[model samples]
Target: MSMLNIPLFFQDTAAVEGDMGMLWMLLSGILVFFMQAGFTLVESGMTRAKNAVNIAMKNFLDICVGSITFWLVGYSLMYGDTSNGWFFWGGFMQGEGADLFFQTMFAATAATIVSGAIAGRTKYTTYIIFSLLMTAVIYPISGGWQWQGDGWLTKLGFIDFAGSSIVHSVGGWAALVAAFMVGPRIGKYVDGKVLPIPGHNQILATLGVFILWLGWFGFNGGSQLAWGGDDATGASTVVLITNLAAAAGGLGALITTWIWYGKPNLAQSLNGALAGLVSITAGCGNMTATGALLAGLIGGVIVVFSIEFIEKKLKIDDAIGAVSVHGVCGAWGTLVIGLWGVDGDTGIGLFNGGGAAQLGSQAIGVLAYAVWAIVLSAIVLGILKATLGLRVTEEEEIKGLDISEHGSIAYPGKRQREFEE
Candidate 1:
């Protein structure tokens, strides 16, 4: 019997369920879509005046290119039904309309994370290619293993309430690999000493951070997939814990940085807020407010120390600290799910009651993502580096991307007077 020839009674229930799923997915998609603006403002404010336009333009183009690529190939690869253990295929044609919309936003997010890492130095053309490849290939394959129904990770009992590993960690790993491949921005390191590259405007960056924090409510909250009744209680709890974690993250970063650095740095505090949000993403629905608070606080402290360690010890130059904020803290958040999620009914920590099973599962998930992301990113970046040349020439580097690549200055005629003075 043809699908269209099926009896009305049989078809009606399926149709209703499909519509509800689409609605939930659409709401979540809208929330994730707004993150682009948050990223643009945050990245632009964190860099030098000479490169602000370039930074903003890269973010804009990432959304554009990323959306197209994901629609064309990413969505199917990521969530398409398949049977393979290590790899899956979604064919060329699958997922239409709303399903496409939700997955496209996720693809864009993975692409945008790289923008912050290579902010000042990368060529726009190269960045565009990277974005296209990430959405079209890298992110989809990894996400497929976790989000797709038939995915091995899902079968293994891995639970990522939002996207601590799927989205944030993937981006973070790509950024870490790219930063090492691209090398430090000019004058960032001199005579084996790390030179500070102060953000052009902390206030603007702070505003951008706040925008991201606001959007995260929709991010974590929307992931609940429902908002009413006892059936939707999980969604409500997720929202509450997400908010508490964010607040705790801010406080934790503020206190820790104040003690360590002798003052409450606004930038660090802002990062602390983001750190908390990222850390709680994996377990927002599974944890309590208290667990969220502790998780966020630890995430904040981890980001500060991770940032310092990467710069000082590893010599990896991440322009906006994307590596530490997303990569390190994202891993921590995923692990916390094992330690803090409610075991059966009572909310408690692993130290209090939760067993080692969840913790081991969390560790396995983290290790798997780390290995997959780093190896895949290295392969993708290496190919791009060999084929098109990843970094700009020394002449172009000194001239600034706005003028060299786009043939316009971000500040126009102001440069002449500023230089003369």
Candidate 2:
């Protein structure tokens, strides 16, 4: 029957459900947006106190500047019409306002991940330019490859349920390139001996992790897109698995650090939780609870070793372990789907009796994202380095970016003499 002929009750019921879905989506986006604060706190707390304000500024920029860029063009690039299965130019704001809002947060997240890795030494202006490019161009193109229904990776059956590779790894790999280009913080490596530069406040970092853990419910669960019908169950399961993975990850890291360092290390344990979160993000909608736990456990363990290797062996300075937590675990999360993924009653992973095709597809997607992120990051950062410069001067490095770049301090009247040197 036509809408005009339909009963008011029936029409109201249908409209209510639709409205509820919109509310869920927008709320989830808000939760994800709050994660910027989590990121800021984690990064600032993990670095020297003098650079805390600078760290805060970078994160603020990620959301503020990132939202505008995404609204203007990034959203269109990611979800617009396309026949070539690559990307599209659907003009400005071509989709639903709610979708654009949700995706804007993701774009900001991809850009913010880099801020933590290059925390102590990067220039503010250079970071601004990079953030704009990342939110506007780099992340959207890669994201379209999978999230967009018409994209090639989507056509190939690549499964990244909630962007382990699309969002986290893209950011993670970009972080790797940016860190390498900017080089290590002063005194991080002296004459081949690795020096430990403990964060100014572990408490803040710990709190930040808690906030991120809370925010992740929205990150993974919100990806469900609806709250009625089977969507309610699906979103709930995603939240449960995400929590299980994060808890398992924290435990895994805690245990590994105790064994390796002969003591329980809080820092590694914190990152382990995040690593587990990243590990399960790609497979959260596909894996069983057991599979998610195992994946998270392995991800937590992997992060500890990856952090050591990057800092001690590879000699790269990732101030907050972003590369290992996001990049390495992101790839692992994507691959885990091919090993334990399930589609209702059907098993799709190799260990679950499915063939190797899904595994192969996952690997290809992982490799593709890595290469694309690395190459583009290198080109962008390289140009910025040669032109506007990437790092602050040696004098500014010792004095801190807060005073040098912003002409303000996070905490006033506190003697930074100890932190400056």
Candidate 3:
């Protein structure tokens, strides 16, 4: 009778554990879904008031379209069986319901990053098409190469605990190519002079950053994919480390801008926090607390310089600095694992007594993603430019996409004069 009781007890425990994990995944996915609101607020706040509604629409449709497409095909391609150790085909919508729900949020996130970079000028229909392709094809294929567990990068020992390179960098690279192909916002650069286009509402942008910081807990923690025993501890630790990095990133930008610009810049400081989050995402599981802080700090400082370089030197108009915050810092975050990564009692980085192997693998992963996102994004944008058109007409753009594209305004009546005058 005692022996029978033991077996029953173990069975009950296993059932409880399974239920807990499912609950965690559902909660985490909800948090990640909330990030769409954060993105919409950030992008809309950082651009002119006239284009605010357009920015919201892009972010909204990213999830709407991304969910249906990913459910139908993207999930199969990402987590499905491999045909050549590079791509996959698992069949349509065949995964566990919880897993599918959680992953759908990530796919949408990667697609929405581009909206902020090319806001104010891009056509609404064209943006929707690009978002669909990104969520369905570009994001899933590359993600499978790592998250699928049997892709080439996984076999190469490439480590991206979350998705610094997989999600953020892919989005960043697409932003870079799209921004370049679409060209700078009108009057942004005239006669080789760089013009400043300030965002309409700093208050909204600030609120958006706070929301994003909160959502990142679920973003990093949910990636653990379990809630039993050590999984709980690991997920909690990742959340704490994620917070430390975000705080360090904000401070790093605050100080850097204070010295470089002779004053603290709120926009740069906000972006710095985001950059830090992107930097630590890849190594959050493998890094020490100290390493996470340093990684975020460096990422914050790097974003300031990178934003200036892209706009001033490259002449690209990335309205919200998405490319620097996500793309460049995402690469930095992935590569930093080679300097301070740990695996149980063993080190996984050169500076920490691992070796050059991990670093080399990281470099290869970074370059591969850059090339993939750039080449594919450019091709898609090029086709759109030739066919349906990418940007709105100059007259339509100046009129504000809210009125021109949606035939309505985000802020009407007396508030219109602030932008018009």
- Residue runs of model 1 more than 4 Å from their true location after superposition: 1-24, 82-96, 229-233, 343-349, 416-421
Positional deviation of residue 276's Cα in model 2 after best superposition, in angstroms: 0.7
- The TM-scores of all predictions, comma-separated, are 0.89, 0.94, 0.93
- Supply the TM-score for candidate 3: 0.93
Using alpha carbons, what is the TM-score of model 1? 0.89
Summing lDDT over every window of 10 consecutive residues in candidate 3, give the lowest-scoring window. Answer: 83-92
- Quickly count the clashes in candidate 1: 0
TM-score winner between 1 and 3, please give it.
Answer: 3
In model 3, pairs of residues that clash are none
Which pairs of residues clash in candidate 1, taking residues 3 or more apart in a chain or in different chains?
none
Runs of candidate 3 with Cα error greater than 4 angstroms are 1-11, 82-95, 229-233, 415-417
- Scanning candidate 2 in windows of ten residues, the lowest lDDT window is 83-92
Clashing pairs in 2: none
Best by lDDT: 2
The top-ranked prediction according to TM-score is 2
Mind giving the per-residue lDDT tens digits that candidate 2 earns over 82-162?
Answer: 432233334334226677789999999999999999987999999999999999999998998999888889888899988
lDDT of 1 by residue, 24-112 (tens): 66776787788888888788778776677788888889889888777667776786653322232333333245556777787788788
410: Cα error in model 2, Å: 1.3
